[model samples]
Target: MIKACALLLLAFNCCAAEIEGLSAIGVGGIPMARQEAIQDALMQASLWNGAKVEASSSVENGRVSELQRVFPVQILDRYKLLREWREGSFYHVMIETDPKPDPVPAEKIAASAPAEVLATPVAAAAQGVLAKPVPVRECAQSDFAYRKKLLLAHFQLQNPADANDLSHFQDGLQQELSRMLSASDHYLPQRTVNEAAFNLQPGFYDPVLQPERVRELARRYGTQFVVGGVIRDIGAYGEQYGLAWGSDIRSGERKISASIPMLKLNGWMPAVAELGLKIKPSSRRFEADVYVFDGASGALLKQQRFADSATGDVIQGRDYIFGSRRFYETDFGKMVEQQLEQMVAGVDQALACQAFAARISRVDKDRIFIDAGSTARITKGDKLQLFRVSGSNQLVPAVNGDSSMSLGTPEALLSAVTITQVQPLFAIAILESGSIRPEVGDYVRFSMKESR
Candidate 1:
């Protein structure tokens, strides 16, 4: 990551007042790049001092010939080019400025009072007071994690033979888990039929996995994470017995009994007793290992095993009261729902531990546009922090699976902003403080909390 420093550079010899500035430039087309760097530097300096400066430039062959900036508040005491270098596509230069030896007269300060930016010519404004670019930095642990679009794939069954219908069990678990997750305040779950592989090489699991393929699926769904799981064990269990009822024909009385029938009891009776089937303490068990992966990097973020069981009673081969036995309404469904509840809570908590941010797409005067909108749980009147990019670099692999890493450190805070208008996929905001102007590709974020 690149680090840009902004501090008090130099003090005047004769005057008590001090002024300072630091600026860096990257490579583009030679003339254009230099021009941009110089302009940005001046604007950054102006932001620090909160004063507008005037510029005069001479052009040569449609390029910059000579450029001079005049600070109406004070004169420059001294200046120096601190450092210059080339990295990747950017040519960086850091410059520092000092204040003049003598203070300006009071009447001069009054005469050069700043005017409205719109009243100036476009050329002058462009070359005039640009707010200092805030430095971009690594997000702290307290950073916000936005609710993201997510996809839950069908869980693979560890013991397929244990499930009478593998597809049904997988679908059942997936749907229930999705329901629970969608109900939470942590994520916006997206339903998808995409199947992601579990293991790369042949292992105890089925369907060979390719990490790249999983990432592609996530991209297609515009989701930040993909959830998958394995059904480790599942089964339905119960015992059945017979109950008997007898009637005394003469007395018109009836007797009912249940017993472990043996050969020694009252021998037998015809048309006096009837036997019916009954189930005792029937139960269904569900156990699964759930895994969550980063959609951008295909790395596992969380994993856990969750299990639960539900029990019920049956009489005459039917529910004790409902008089029917259906898959969805039975103990199996109840047990599955319980398992999903646990899984959902686990996933919601895990994802909330991550930081979330939206990128700036455009900037017009005091208003800025962000890439996140209603889908991301952003609303009108929400306040967000703005960061300026100072420097960034790709992280090299120092250990296994670190090749995809990148780092950016923000140096200064621009200002807070509030959402003024919201669309389905984007939002527009205006700065609460105009001391710093936001730029495209800057980051905006807010702290996340559970609403429910």
Candidate 2:
């Protein structure tokens, strides 16, 4: 028995190699169970080697059932057949399988049937039908080395006072950039910290000095973009007055007298700037706006502003003065940090949008087809809704209802279509609804229900 099994295996391999486009056809008197088992085994084998199986169903009663199955196999210019016979069974079982050709050469699959036919064809007969396997390309790590370098530059943060403090910001930026790049599948070069230019001076609004300084720093650091902005105090004041008049009629002279002494006005100042303050208690606060720019071109890419009340005591003889203390300990510093975080988030969003646009352009669908044996991602026996835009002229009521209005109406309807074959670019489906027939270039959408 062992020797016979080995011989059978050898025979199977030889037969499989020699056969081209062998389709399994179950004749009369074959049990459904046996046929199904053979089909399943063939499908498994095809899928295991990246091949595809196309099967047709037997006709029942007087109606033709639109049922077909395709395996995960991909053929590349080769085909095979498998046949099994039971010594006692009356019918011989034959299976036909084909190797998918590369780049799936296109041929018209939906040819019209002959005028006279004994029964409806279960599947469309096309010349050289094949399924191509999805290709997986291995990308070399060196291809992304440039991206790693770019990412490194953006991840590093610099401040003048503490060279080592830049690392803290760098760590934060690295986490942010890492998450963004991972989600986007993008990479950039690693950025090294510029120890000489790590300065984040607050409340310093020297536009002339700052712009050149930032540009120079960016060039030295080998960065294409640099983001820098200033925080300032903007203040305003206003006043309102009320008038009172007193009239006196003395000695029937009808004399009226009005006197205006002084009217004091009061209003709230929106914001104030205070320097060097700890996080204490105060009613005054300020607003901070941070802007990011392209390092090379000095283009304003993004900006965000936040408002927070000062929380500390005021200095003597000064109006709304927040006393000098540790700058980092002050609420102003905290606000700056908050603004920085928001700026980073905005930059990340911009990067994501750029990546998404690039990815989407690669996969925009141009056309779709529905028929039995049409290649698609849909499974066998699944229903899809077919739709197309229809234009018609209709009479609608005018705005005043005095005159009739003729308008062109554009509408769409869903027709039930069942999937027969799912291929890479198109799906083969049968129209379930006799009333609606889908034409080429019509939209095709999937639906689970017969009517929707």
Candidate 3:
């Protein structure tokens, strides 16, 4: 069997093309033959199912110009480039390999297999032999991991003052901060929550003393960062309400005075309130600004602010305060969760946008060529949009006999062409629309309407 296999391989090699300066296995180096094969393989990949290729050449510029003229036919794994060499007297070729396709998700394979096979450990153990183990390493403590202490100091208004109400409000704030931290993926360890302290002041606004208070707490708690803010009265108004005892009883009218308290706080409170208001039945208004600073230098790294309102009802014995004055339990808690989620989403979007920007690069074409073959990441049937970045005067041509005669202006549109082949740098697209034939050096962009 071995002798037969060897003989068959020998026969195959003998029949293979013997192009000069080309490698057959792609190991010796990329030559015309191997490059052609790689380009063909790229076209075969599902990424370019329907694509076309065009050809053109330039004389004045060097190899770089020719390369620019050549379009990317397919996307290969960056690691696939193995060898490169000169082809004939004028052409330089590069050979590459296809990237390994992503493995089937474990869930998919398990779902397809027999239930008994999936349930038993035998199959899993057998598969383990073929799979790579994830590496585990111990984590080291760093400056980024160091935890800081946060203190929120604010003044509470005592109109029919209740110490228990203030306590409940403080508890609500702490709970909200905890939820926000838990929801975030980047939260650091060693976060110490200091007990919220409320002071009695006559005025609606109290000086925000949390910064200094945080420093004091940090010394006592051995923490790195501090957070604080205040609560003040923004405005107040009166609402009229009617209470009826029975159908025969005339409704008794009464006016209730409502006061708006401004809670100027640091860190997560205001943010949670802002997000919570998006939910229905919340009416607690708050504005919070949070900042992270260096432990020693107090240099700020991250800062953000959020504002929102909460409204609903508060029960007072037999009577209920229903108009916009709600106790901080129900609405406040819900708001905190919503705010945390929004903050996390905002951070994720910003990071993703940055990453996306880094991956896309721009290239200009000097000549026109049909993108062809399976290796070029082109498909057998794909359409592309072509555009030219020419000046308005160049775009509009003068009448042949009358230079003064105005012709219609040119506009950008999608190419009416099917892709036949895809190459490394370029693709071959057949014109499907317009009477004018696209020439070399015409700028083209592609959109995948039917991606594989």
C-alpha RMSD of candidate 2 = 27.7
RMSD of each: 21.2, 27.7, 25.6
Give the residue spans of candidate 3 off by over 4 A: 1-167, 188-216, 219-224, 232-284, 300-304, 314-452
lDDT of 2 by residue, 343-451 (tens): 5555554332221100000112322353212222245665444555342222233466422122212336444455555664345555555455445445443311110
Q: For model 1, how does the per-residue alpha-carbon lDDT over 1-452 read when each residue is reduced to its tens digit?
A: 22222111121234333232223332113323333344344334433443334444455566664433334243231334455555555555554544423444443333343333223455224434433332222112222335666778767766666664333556656666666677775677766663743552336453354445556666566566788877777765664343533331111112344454452354774332344343343565678788887665555677788987766621112221211125445555555655677888788666765655566888988789987788787888776766664533322223555423222123455666778999988899887666676787676755322121
Index of the highest-lDDT prediction: 1
Model 1 stretches with alpha carbons more than 4 Å out: 1-146, 165-167, 197-211, 237-283, 311-329, 358-371, 381-420, 428-452
* Model 2 error, position 232 (Å): 1.4
Report every candidate's CA lDDT.
0.53, 0.33, 0.33
Candidate 2, poorest ten consecutive residues by summed lDDT: 2-11
Please give, for residues 160-227, the per-residue lDDT of candidate 3 as tens digits.
23222233444344444544543443232133343433223556343222223333444453333333
The TM-score that candidate 3 achieves is 0.28
| Clashes within 3 Å, all models in order | 13, 45, 77
Query: What's the candidate order when arranged by decreasing TM-score?
Result: 1, 3, 2
Backbone clashes counted, model 3: 77
lDDT of 2 at 345: 55
Best by TM-score: 1
